[model samples]
Target: MKFIIVTGVSRGLGLGLTKALLSSGYKVAGCSRSRSDALNELEMSNDNFKWFPCEVGDATQTQTFVSDACQWAQAPLWGLINNAGIAKEGVLATFPNVDSDELLQINLNGALYMAREALRMMLRQNSGGRIINISSIIGSRGYTGLAAYSASKAGLDGLSRALARENGRRGITVNSVAPGYLDTEMSSTLSDSKRAQIINRTPLGRLGTVDDVAPAIEFLLSDGAAFITGQTLTIDGGITN
Candidate 1:
């Protein structure tokens, strides 16, 4: 079975993506800052699924996580999903310096560390692989109060484009998925009015779902998408338009 690495698998979109990948018969190496009961249950049920606790922002920890994953899989990696990220919201003028730094560490540096290690493994395997970075619609279209978050995500998109160019010759493809507001815990804190406003603005008249996003990710990792790289696929219900 092909092995895939998915970070931030303890909850929300990460959890949904892990479940979807496992269901589709890929061996998944997943990680999060802490172990959740849901992830433990998944581990117990799926022999193909392994969970590693990691702080993706830490380069050493991330590298160790990927190395251990390679050992555990005992095979070449087929794909990687740099899905670990944290959201920090504040007006650009007063956004705490600490929060801004922390946001970029997790959202951008984390992906960088993980992708660097994953690329090492993929290169050693001498086989083409897929790397999918999870971004935000806010990256392309700025949102008030999310300037730091948007900057980090926009950096991730730029990273994807550069890596796609650098690694294409190695048979590895790099791309990103930018999703708008989804019906996940991250969006639960928004006020009802705010949520309604977002939905009304979405041409689909609803928030995006994990189900809606996971399938697109799955497709991007498939052979069909071999020719599609250095691109950002936005799943925002046309809100960015």
Candidate 2:
């Protein structure tokens, strides 16, 4: 079985993607800073699913997680999904320096660290693999009170692009999926009026869902997407349009 590693697997898109990948017959090694009941349930129900505890922003922890996950899988490292992130809402000037640092470490530096570890394994195996960073539309479109979050995501895309160039020759493709305003925990803080405004502006008339974005990740990992690299796929409800 092809083994893929996913980060931030406790909830939201990370959890959803883990389920989808397992159902599709991929062995997944997932990690989060904290365990969720959902993670426990998935492990109990699916032999293909296993969860680990990890804080992606910590370089030492990240290194250990990937190494341990791969050892446990005992399968070819096929892909990696850098879905671990944290978002803090605040105006740039007022946002605590500590909070901004944490956001960047987790959202951008963490992905880079995860990709580095995954690429090392993939390159050693000499099998081309996929690295998909979970970015946000705010990276490109921008939003109020999320300047740090936006900067982190924008940096993620830049990481994807540069890594794609660096590794394309090895058949390893790097890309990012930037989902629009989604009905997920991350976007739960939107006020009622703000939520309504988003829905009205979206061409599809609603927020994006985890399911809506999961398949795009799956496709990117498939043979069908072998030629695709360094691209940012926007899976919004045409809101970006």
Q: After superposition, how far is residue 232 of candidate 2 from its true place, in Å?
A: 0.3
Which segments of candidate 2 are over 4 A away from where they belong?
none
Encode model 1's per-residue lDDT on 55-174: one tens digit a residue.
999999999999999899998999999999988777989989999999999999999999999999899889999999999999999889999999999999999999999999988999
Candidate 1: give the clashing pairs.
Answer: none
Quote model 1's TM-score: 0.99
lDDT of 2 at 158: 94
Residue 56 lDDT, candidate 2, scale 0-100: 91
The per-residue C-alpha lDDT of model 2 at residue 74 equals 91
TM-score per candidate, chains pooled: 0.99, 0.99
